[model samples]
Target: MSSTDPDVDHALAYPEPPASPLWHRQGAKARPLTDAQKQRNCELLLLAQHKPRTHRRAEKPACSPT
Candidate 1:
């Protein structure tokens, strides 16, 4: 089989970088965080900690004993 198929090459191409999150931009700035910003950051941290992907467990299969 040929290793240079256009479809395969397209699929293998490097993906675009993910967009920066809100905190990333804030971190880049030198200004101190405000009270509201601190609260927002805390909320974001809590959300990230408990987000579905982070907290989800492997779903159990339904019982099917014969």
Candidate 2:
């Protein structure tokens, strides 16, 4: 067998590579969250957008007679 070929395994004749960290792995699964927790997070984010979602803005502000 020729070792100069690109497909040839040179590590088998030497040694294997070192292991990588957990973050480096691409197949890790994330933990699931409760429905209530998810909703709370979403609501808090929406509140930051400053939209007119409160009852105080249901009607337009009274304009002064000019």
lDDT of each: 0.56, 0.55
Q: Give the runs in model 1 whose Cα sits over 4 Å from its true position.
A: 1-29, 54-66
TM-score of each: 0.34, 0.33
Q: For every model in order, what is the number of clashing pairs?
A: 0, 0
lDDT of candidate 1 over 1-66, digit per residue (tens) = 376655443553578878778546544558788877776666555555653646543344232222
C-alpha RMSD (angstroms) for model 2: 14.2
The C-alpha local distance difference test score for the whole of candidate 1 amounts to 0.56
Error of 1 at 19 (Å): 30
- Model 2 worst lDDT run, 10 consecutive residues: 57-66
Q: What stretches of model 2 exceed 4 Å from their correct place?
A: 1-28, 51-66
Q: Candidate 2 on 1-66: residue-level lDDT in tens?
A: 667667855557667768767547567567787776676565555555546556342233333222
**What TM-score would candidate 1 get against the native?**
0.34
